[model samples]
Target: MSEQLAEERASARPIPGQVGGRAVMLIPRRDPGTDESMLPPDYQRIIAAVRQAAGPVMAREVGEGVGVDVSVKAKLEPLRGKLVRLVDRGWLQKLPDGRFTTRL
Candidate 1:
């Protein structure tokens, strides 16, 4: 791993029960810090669902767990987008095989 990745991994502290009764690893705020005010309600729900699963979950599985009607492609699309955004934001890690897990 690169030095930055190594440092990030090392610096992350485990936050128990931060999500869905599971332990989550969180990297301390680097500067401006976490802005919960910016997250939409749906996004928060998705995060909670991801935490409950507590592993590298596929998009469809996350949507199903979150109670989204997985039978409809349209409904799944937005949820998938939200999951991607969460991964981009460093709150999640996308595995090489396209699975997702909490960054911690």
Candidate 2:
């Protein structure tokens, strides 16, 4: 067998009870199903926070409140990107005033 094929096969396994499931795992697309998709756990938490706020909240507020350092120049900035994705995915709405709120 080709080394590449052997590696792929070795990395795949049947789920505990999903023998009928797809044999090859699929990586999610970067921008999939924005209109009718479920938010990831972290995004859900951010939205919950926005919902609890007095009004729409800034990305940094939500990011820091959710435990992300968010130091403008952080070596690896993830929270802000997640927030942007949440907006892009329709899980959150960005106001003209530059804040985020749960989509109606």
Candidate with the greatest TM-score versus the true structure? 1
lDDT of 2 by residue, 1-104 (tens): 67776565545432323336846322222232232223445656777778888888887778667776667647225666666776775667888887888777
The global C-alpha lDDT for each of the candidates, from Candidate 1 onward, is 0.69, 0.61
Tens-place lDDT per residue, model 1, 53-86, is: 8677888888888899999999988888777777
Displacement of residue 51 (Cα, Å) in model 2 is: 1.3
For residue 6, give model 2's deviation from the true position in Å.
38
Cα lDDT for residue 65, candidate 1: 84
Clashing pairs in 2: none
Q: What is the alpha-carbon lDDT for the whole of candidate 1?
A: 0.69
- Ten residues in sequence with the least summed lDDT for candidate 1: 27-36
